[model samples]
Target: MKSKIFCDNTAALMAAVREGAEGATIEIAAGVFELEATLELKARMTLKGAGIGKTILTHVAGWKPSTKSLPDPEMRLDGLDTDAYLIRLKRDTAGITISDMTLLGPQLHGAIFAWFPTSLHLHHLRIKETLWSGLRTFGMQKAKIHDCEFVDAGGRWDSGQPGVKGGITGGGIFAIWMSDCEIYDNRFVRTRTGPAQEFYGIKVRQGTRCRVHHNTIETNFSMEFPFENDEDNEIDHNVCHGTISIPKYAGGVVPKSGRTFHIHHNWMKDSYALEFVRNGVEIDHNLFDFDVKQDHGNLISAFGNVAAKGPASFHNNLVSNPGRGVIWINEVFNNLEIRNNHIVTRTTTTPRTEGLFGFNPGSDFTSIAIKDNLVECQGLARPLLRAPESYAAIVENNKLTNVSDAKKLTNAKANRPVGLENPLAFRCGAHEEFTVSGWKVRPTKK
Candidate 1:
């Protein structure tokens, strides 16, 4: 197949592909091409642009259908009948690359909707302002999304309520049923923020051997892994400024049982950091930095099957300036190991309220271990670790300062310096060379 180049007409670009220009390099020159229909790729090819923000592709105006009879259908961003996606990679297509382009979906439903691709690579692309989602893929074997930016992706849905559970769905990148995929060195910024169904920076569900690392997700709401039985997934070295939740019912299914997930070496600051409501998860060597705000607070919150029989470990983490508490061990499951963590409270003279750790009601700590932790507070007067009488298992070597006596707690130590520095100074985002574990990271150019 011969390579073709299109400068202005997007219809000619699609026409070239339809006329058996498969397995070829289709270069789009530096200009704004308004798409009239969804560009479909059926064969293995490369869709390259001049550069990011240099070659622009956008939707045609009046693309959204109008319904005058259905009582203000203009306000409905969801369920709009549009057969338009900026790029559609059809099923069973292998070895496709879409790189170095700015896809602006103003009236389109989604930017890229790909399914069942054998191999897909999205590199150095800026996909923004998408109405539904930036990039959505399903049933892929090998996929690599690196050095890309997904900004302001999802749109708002009106469920009649204004501030409460507004029906907002879709955002950033959502990959499901993927195997051996690497989503790294990407930036998801300013995504839609509302209810849980509204927006997400990056969401991977029911994936196997997927590694999502070294990505910067700064948005109203961060990441989610909802469904269960996702085996051997690693989320590491990412910096998230918002909430990273594993909700109780993601995709309407309880992920009570699954393979273990290793979450480590990440920086979660500002909002609620890690909210895990499932088992088979390990969180370690992460920095949870929260500068006490009344609206947005809390560090680590875990609530799930209190009777599950597996062990989950939270170790070697640094928690600083906690607004609500350091850890909210809501419901006690079997065998939770909290060890080697350093918790330091902010210096405040406002009467020293709020417990360092809050144990919610109906929590049974029969087989939980809290050991070798260092807690330093400035004005907290409450008990450092607040829990029930049954929560008395292996609490030892915890050095405390400016906290009340460890009467109910056992094996306590004292007089330890709060020598932990700010962990946010370390860079957790993407780098030029991908030197992490799992997959070998490489840039697009080289």
Candidate 2:
């Protein structure tokens, strides 16, 4: 393996990159390297550093040079004309690996920007304090980003930058038009000290065959799938401490109609665990603990004309302490299934609110099934499922506890008092199961 060493100069580092072979590895020594301009990378090489905090790369102060001076410039750099990035991977570059480095961006842009790379890997990196996203990739294939930390990204509050007008920007990681990417075992935390914006921990648009799993995401908006037109993408086994949003039409871009999105085996501690606007989505085997005191604490909120596109299913989930309801169905649908789930709510001092499940008025349905579920609430004063008189649902084999109203329970196959002694226990993967009684549901079915 051919190698070159650079101490603290980015210009020399670029020169070394230009002289290195295709499979060479550039070892950056421990020091702070202030970049006067973006280091354009067009070769299939490895940029390795001593360690995360030991080797830091930062942008120059108030210096925004033209991309023409870079090694391989593209017209898309016009979007970043006024801003500067620490590293830019050319579209022609492939098999590039960046590991064990700290990247700080003060230009209100991204730390690393890549376009159409065939292969890329980023591991063991600490990317922080970016004005916009920490890592932005467009049209990349076969990418792996793991064991990295993205902190204090989307620094709009501190940078005084106006909110993004049209496109989705300012996040920990933003990938547009990507394919076959794996982002796992990473940490995304927004530590900005100010009002939050419509940013996300990770945002993917028009992506295909991506896997975002085992990530610990903590931000204002944890994840967003704005108009994903792809198929067979998986978002599983993630610990999200904020809302997972699928924002409505913003800036003339509506959620694209898609198929086969598997969202399962996740732990969410937010008001809205999964808020989606499109159809053809499956949400299962997740634990939602709504710790936020919001008026509309819903486990799943499906909006738009979802029934027109394709079938959607929500099953085998556990919801605990939902402030408002369990599922808020806004639009009419042809096929919708909510089965084999558990919802538990405790008595609250606030006035008893609406039912546990609310379906909007005038919403027509062709085929809807709600079965084999359990609702255990202590202090709710309304019916468990509220629907219009015209809307007829096939409800069966559900157990209710401490609910007085029987208007919606007329179709229940069986009603029995919830046993408090056995309680509920849940475990994901190979971990030990933890038990919680008196209102918490188990991860799996009884």
Candidate 3:
């Protein structure tokens, strides 16, 4: 059941897809195909184009998306408007590949919407300027979306719209209930401003065993996996100008393989690098480089009555010019270990005398360990620990410069993280001509 069609116009393209058998390959020619309605993707088919920017697909002139809010059976949400998408996968579609075209949008929802697709592959496509999101999915498995560009891809999160935090907010790639997916080597950028200016780069809910790496995202919230039982997720080797947010106890019960999430080896330039607490997570071998002039936010912060189930650890990180100090836990947390890091702080407008680490007095200090750290503060003296005096017993073998009578001070060398080089340095975006490594601190591999 294999067939091939070469089409240039909308009618030919639509007829080719509708009539073509399974395992068909439709190669769209170099022209602008104005879509009259949603293009349904068939199973085991390939939608090919001449090239990006050479072949374009967009909505018809004066066409508008339906304002109806329809229920999505895949996500179990009554918020999505299916009439807003240009291309959609057929129910229970599998082994579909869409590549080498521009899905231009300022459309209502997004460019491509799918549900319950298996082994879907998307590459070398530019999804730009969508009102909701560039790509939206539900229950996608073993999908690979790489080398794509999402430029100004999402906005429009008004109240009661069913998004992040009940606000209809979307992102460049918003997928709910995804598993075994790999999203890498993509660039998510916001170039222009309008009502479509607020969203995340990659937003996932209940994602399991997903690997997100080698991306250069410039959105305000680069990556978010929040408020779900997301497990066995790996985030590493990327360049993020915004926050890598995984808060609200997103890590569920640790699997027998150990650790719900493994986050490491990423270059972070934002002051608010990471968000709240979780259990059975290991964060190591990362660079948290924040400029002194940026807004004040902690590198790691948690607040409110967070019933944290612990055994989370952060070690071997290099932090520079922390705006409001590191690791501020406002509530009682247990089984957190912070060790073998180097932090350097300079004189800033904010309080310079605050402790580098602060925890609630009611926390189980016996389970917490802050050891083998090297802190160097220029000009003023800063306290090592700001909690109760009992915390002093846990703060052992730290080298705090210019702090008088530091308890258990040691002359041993700090265990700095090796191979802290930026992986995406000197690499530009795949489609666009944007330089990724324009930061002040660019580390090359030695």
Candidate 4:
């Protein structure tokens, strides 16, 4: 293995890059640099900062955004294009590990990203003031983001265009967009937008087989963190916190499975809106805490729905002092299984801890089973009624405890009757089974 190569400026770095072969480890010393265009790395390169603590790269204040500047909708650029960066790659830059640097994205233009790239590894870095996304990955595989921090991103939140999408500019509205990639061990705070608007911390879309673990995704003003429309992804051991700010919308985790999404062993706390639509949801060994009751419009909740149906499998989870229950399948669906969960709801949250009154499954769901769980009904229980679509909901052999209010139990509001007369004691403080940030995002070896 070779020792190292040093570069003073981006031009020198590009010169070394052009002269080097595959698998080059370029050690960049701590310095300020300029970037006018996208640096394409065709080979596997490890661009290491002298030290993550000492290395620094700053860019020009970039393009300012608005309809006036970008007359063309085809413009990829978004806000003040502080897109000039320390280093960014385009085209087949695989096996690349970028470590230890404070790379700045500050421009008076649109999105700081003048170029879009695919397949890269970013480790131990800090990015501030990205006009669009902090990191833009088109469609990459086997890439990882580790030990990074994004502070006060998604700059300059105006009333975006009428149909302007999320994670567009300045505000880090969009960070890390890709497929089959892993985003773990990162921090996003004060990554905000305008008054009633917070932006998305991490967005997963058009991606598969991706895992998001051990990240503190919080403190934005416009939208939800981990905004997921992506399919067949695993979101485990993540802390989803803070006031989810969207103007006319509510934010929540939707099980996009059919398209395929599996949610297991994750903590959902201080959340605004979470929904499930058109998917098979496997919710197991997770904790749901809906602490702040600031009213996300309709009702402050851990889980709420617009189109709620689950080919939904919910088991082995715990909900304590939240604003709602675990299952709120408001629409119709097949195979709704509820098992082995500790559900606790205050009287101020909903009517009962477990019931079929508010959100029910579709009539076509014939397989609805509730077994081996401790359920507390502060107000009413057994308001479950079956839909006319054709279904069955059976409750058997479980501990239904602390349900003393007799006026809350009525007959069949939405599903079949299985009201338990003999119940057991319920516990409130049950967490999950696995450790946090279980996957490694950065590999030390080349």
Model 1 clash pairs are 168-198, 352-379
Candidate 4 structure quality by residue, lDDT tens digits, 203-317 = 4334466777666666542223233444666666665554332111122234333524556555556534344443444666655555524323111222333443445566666
Clashing pairs in 3: none
In candidate 3 the C-alpha lDDT for residue 128 amounts to: 85
Model 1: CA > 4 A from native: 1-8, 65-82, 155-166, 191-198, 248-259, 303-307, 347-352, 359-364, 412-426, 432-446
By summed lDDT, which 10 consecutive residues of candidate 2 come out lowest? 429-438
Indicate the residue-level lDDT of 343 in model 2. Answer: 75
Candidate 4 lDDT at 422 equals: 29
Candidate 3 residue 67 Cα shift, in angstroms, is 5.0
RMSD of each: 6.2, 5.7, 4.3, 8.1
- Specify the poorest-scoring 10-residue window by lDDT in model 1: 65-74
lDDT tens string, model 3, 1-446? 58889998899999998888878999999989998888888999999998889899898866676434522332564666766888898877999999999998764568999889999999999998776778989899999999899988875533345443323567899999989999988998988754437778998887799998878898888888887877889987777888887775523566776777888767778888888776778887777788877738788877657567577888877778777778887766778888777777777676556777778777777788877776788776666666664353365666678653365333344454322222323432222233334233433433
lDDT of each: 0.67, 0.67, 0.76, 0.49
How does candidate 4 fare on TM-score? Answer: 0.68
Clashes of 1: 2
Give me the candidate number with maximum lDDT: 3
**Tens digits of per-residue lDDT for model 1 on 160-251?**
44574433456688666778999999988774444533567886666778888989888755787764556677888887777777634311
Model 2: which residue pairs collide? none
